[model samples]
Target: MKPLRKIIFPAAGLGTRFLPATKASPKEMLTIVDKPLIQYGVEEAIAAGMGEIIMVTGRGKRAIEDHFDISAELEANLKSAGKSALYKEVSRVARMAEVIYLRQKEALGLGHAVLCARHWVSDEPFGVSLADELIIHEKPAMQQLREVYDQTGCSVIGLIQVPASEVSKYGIVDYTTEEGGLLRLTDMVEKPGMDEAPSDMAMVGRYIFTPRLMQLLKAVQPGKGGEIQLTDAIAVLAKEEPVYGVLLEGQRFDAGNPEGFLLANAVIGLQHAEYGESLRKSLQEYL
Candidate 1:
């Protein structure tokens, strides 16, 4: 088991859920507070000691690359304006990690997006975090998965117990609980209906994958919507090896959708330094 050294962010989705707003810009570039969604995932990866950030991007996603690149003009302008703090902040984004971008070319699906990064990930274990999902925890969520990987050397997926009625909204897991809170996943179904759902423990976007998982992805045929779903690959992988889903100890937000995006803003905004207090007071008055 090699130490996880890389993280892959699948950022090529069309973001149709966001409509015109995401037409020109990527959903990942939408800001939660002051930082873009992708930046949060990058920061989380860095915090977990994963320095290489491989972004599986697509067309119209150049904004993500630009956001992390050195903005010489903007940096100089901020310096000339005597905004030293702002200059330092802007400069840090470019230096966050060794970011490598690979174009997905086509919007196949999450599993396909991960497959595109096969060259970069090579033969080592890696982490995958969807730019849209934000997990607020004491330790970075991926770090938690890395710990599990350390102990079991098994593939780990982050799980959140959603309401039974909402099972169809996500990939639900069927599992057997181990001594720890870890669930040894026996099966997984993508977006199963309420009656078809195996369990309410929905798979969130964070995952730690062994190299062998890529083989499963390659063998998996297109699923619903004619897209290669990552969940389908994971389900097959579970049959031959142990696939563990850890109940993440934190708040998870599906920031990919407009509703979830707004909720993220409100929740994270309440903790913002410049506006949190004022925002809280205003919300109190408005409510």
Candidate 2:
């Protein structure tokens, strides 16, 4: 298997849920404490050994690109102020990895957004990380999927067990577990009703996909929302070939919504060095 060197992030969502806040800003650029959501995902990809990042972006998302690029004036100002630590921190973001952007002209579904990167990804195995899902773990969650891909030589997805009551909120999968929480998925169901859900293991936002999966994505017809769902393509791929899922060892936050976003901020804020103590104290008063 070719080493997984490329990672694609589908970031073109309109963020209608966030309205005015996201009307002008890409949701991926929303900050969790001090770092943007996309930054966390990009940092996770780099930690997992991926060398290249391909972002599927849309209109009003230019800020995402600028965030990852060098800000020469800001760097110079920091250096002149003798804030070496701050200067290095800001400068390191641009130099983290090779970042490339692709425009998704329309607000198509996730599958279409990912398909936009097919030409750049070519015929190699690649990883996908969704910018809005923040997973906190000892090892990067995408790295866990990479480990499963390396061992099985098949497409692997990050899985997390959700309450059966919540199955309607995510793409559910049916699988048999191998040692170490690895699942051999027999089937996948997208946002099924609670009664129709095949299993409790829901597909999280991390994936390591084969080149053929891209072809499958292209063939997927639009489903419920008149948009092609990635889950539909994955369901087809499972029937045609071996696809596995691994229960990610992490605390995942659905940072795409308001409640989850606040929870994510609290969790990450508690870990922040400079503000952790102050934030914790402030939070305790509210509790």
Candidate 3:
């Protein structure tokens, strides 16, 4: 397993739950503190030594591309207006990596969204991160998985210990073995009920996969909600090669859901400079 040089971000979802805000904007453009959700994922990929980033975007997602590319007018206006901090934020994203954009023509499941990037990923192993699922820590989530892949020469995932009652909300793993904190995966089930779940470990935002996983993705038919399931692809790859999970040493927040989004803002806001004191003080009054 060479370095995880390429990463794929699936950002094609219509974000129906977040509309009418999402009606004009891609949900990935929603900010956590000062940064958009997609930038956070892109930074994680860069931190993990990923060289190429492939974003599978869709309609109304041009803003996603523009957010990362060089913005002449915005940069000029900021410079003239003396908005140094805003300039820094926009400029930083522009230089992150070699970002490639591909449009997913239709709203597909997570697995199908990933398949849209097969050409960009080509024959090499790639990383995957969903912007909706934000993992906050000093180190990025994909960086942890890359370290695991470095040592084991196997596919790695960032796993979290979810409550048994909530196993139905995520893809749970069957823990086969554990060498320290990393668990070797034997099986993966998507959205299993509490009683049916093999383990409490849930697949979160980060993943490192072998090129063979692409083959699995191509072969896997759609499951559950008529969209190809990423879990199903990984399950096939598990039988052919070892796939392991690393318990991410960080907090996980899902921004896709309403409650989770507010929680993310609160959690990140508590630590941010631009809004921390004000946000905390304001929220404290309510509490």
lDDT of 2 by residue, 81-107 (tens): 999999999999988999999999987
After superposition, the stretches of candidate 1 with alpha carbons farther than 4 Å from their true spots are none
**Which residue pairs in candidate 1 have backbone atoms (N, alpha carbon, C) closer than 3 angstroms, thus clashing?**
none
Assess every candidate by TM-score. 0.96, 0.96, 0.95
**Winner by TM-score:** 2
Per-residue lDDT of candidate 1, residues 15-108 (tens digit): 9999889989998999998999998899999988889999998888999999999999999999999999999999999888999999999878
Q: Poorest 10 consecutive residues of model 2 by lDDT?
A: 175-184
lDDT of 3: 0.88
Per-residue error for 187 in candidate 3, Å, reads 0.5
lDDT against the true structure, each candidate: 0.91, 0.91, 0.88
User: Which TM-score value belongs to model 3?
Assistant: 0.95
Higher-TM-score candidate of 2 and 3: 2
Task: Please provide, for model 3 over 8-59, each residue's C-alpha lDDT reduced to its tens digit, 9 standing for 90 to 100.
Answer: 8999989999989899999999988877888888887888899699999998
Per candidate, the number of residue pairs that clash is 0, 0, 0
**lDDT against true structure, model 1:** 0.91
Task: Supply candidate 1's per-residue lDDT for 264.
Answer: 90
